[model samples]
Target: MVRLDRITTRGGDAGETSLGEGSRVRKDTARIEAIGAVDEANAALGLLRAQIAAAGADAEADAMLARIQNDLFDLGADLCVPGAEATDARTGRTRLRVSDAQSARLEAEIAAMNAALPPLASFVLPGGSLAAAQAHVARAVVRRAERRAVRLAAEETVNPAVIRYLNRLSDHLFVLARRLNRNGAGEALWVPGGARQG
Candidate 1:
């Protein structure tokens, strides 16, 4: 149980923030950037959830987004500490790290959702019902988070599962967006040169 009794700690007044293992790094470091991207994705998911609730779109999607929101926090925690095998010195317990099971769960969900959606004849244009559009936004943000994590991986020992989770999450969001769009009924598919004047 993590406690945050003080929200306005002057710890980062020097432009350096503490890592999970008590090491301090600049606020703009790759690790922090990756973590910040994940946080942004989580916020996008929150907005998607609100759209879902307001539109009364799909209860199942709301539930799924809720779970994914929690997972993003786990991802942020994993990135906050350096190294895959990092463990807490005081607790002698492994730090919170993403697992293959998490990505696999996302794969399963994506498969289940895609199974019901009609085959796409054209590329999606990222617009549909409000909830679906919000899902698209969340998907784009998750992709950005994945790119940031990949950048961090190039420089540090990032967990492989972190990348996998983000990758699968974007796909999961894409499929879920379709599901939210009435199983592709409300989806806006792109038409090649449809707007061109002949």
Candidate 2:
């Protein structure tokens, strides 16, 4: 686990930050952008966790979110180092990287959770219960993170697992939202023309 010795390092006060390998880059780089998006998504998950806990929702979902939050930290560390070969300057250890196993686990859990939900006849409008609403928010954030990761991959040698995990995480959040909505009991379905004036 990485320890924070100081909270106010002012490291990025010059618009540059250090990577996992001790290399410095502009804070606005694609890698940093991707990491920022992932961090935001993780924060959204935290909000969802709090909402679910307050509502006394399912314990499994809470545990899942906690695990995903930890996974997001790993992902942030992975994005800190570019390419497939980078040894940390301080620890002299290979930088962290997302793996296929993480994505695979998300897929499996998504399948299991989705199995209990009803068929969706229309688009979801990001509402049902408070917990579900927050889950939807988290899902949207994860989608943004996935897009940023994809853009980074196009420019550099990104691990396929990173993109894969983001993709699966969004799907998992979607299914989790549905599941938390009491298995689609009263979801706010979208109607394409229902809002138009007749």
Candidate 3:
């Protein structure tokens, strides 16, 4: 088992940090922002998972969220490593690249979830259950992260998979918010005096 306390070493106090592959870089590096964004998104998802678990939702959703948490960790690793190549501790080989297959999977998940949701006629107000609201917040943060990654791409070689991942993840979170609102018995709030169906 991994000890939680061993993760932080205060190595970033001087505005310098180490990547997952053991290369030291500045804290404000594009790679670092990309990784940090994934971390923030993962934490937001954790909050949603905890809310769902506490509300006694089905085990399947909770299980999915757990898998997402792990995937985000891998994503962070991918972003942190330079040139998308890192020596794998377990395999003793350079393991990198996020893979087109992973991006496809996220797309598939988003499609599946959106299929069950009602068609949207108006802009959504991002609030309902605590979980739904937080999911929306996560979605927005992921968009910001995507922008940062794009900026980095302009100056460096970034894995295209990272871009695709963020795009799909935002879609996933949007659908997730709808799902949580439905499942948690929270009503979707329309804006006051908003236009109705034509």
Which numbered prediction scores highest in TM-score against the true structure? 1
Instruction: Give per-model CA RMSD.
Output: 1.4, 1.9, 3.9
Write down the lDDT of every candidate, Cα atoms only.
0.93, 0.90, 0.78
Candidate 1: stretches off by over 4 Å = 86-91
Model 2, residue 151: what's the lDDT?
93
44: Cα error in model 1, Å: 0.3
lDDT per residue (tens digit) for residues 81-122 in model 2: 878655656678877778888989999999999888988988
**lDDT minimum window of 10 residues, candidate 1:** 82-91
lDDT of 2 at 103: 89
Query: How does candidate 3 fare on TM-score?
Result: 0.83
TM-score of model number 1: 0.95
What does candidate 3's lDDT look like per residue over 1-198, in tens digits? 345868677888899988766889988888788788888889888888888888887576677678778877777777877665446665688766677777787778778777877777666788898778888998998888888888888888787888888888888888888888884246465666768645
Which of candidates 1 and 3 is the stronger one according to TM-score? 1
Candidate 3 ranges beyond 4 A from true positions: 1-10, 85-92, 183-198
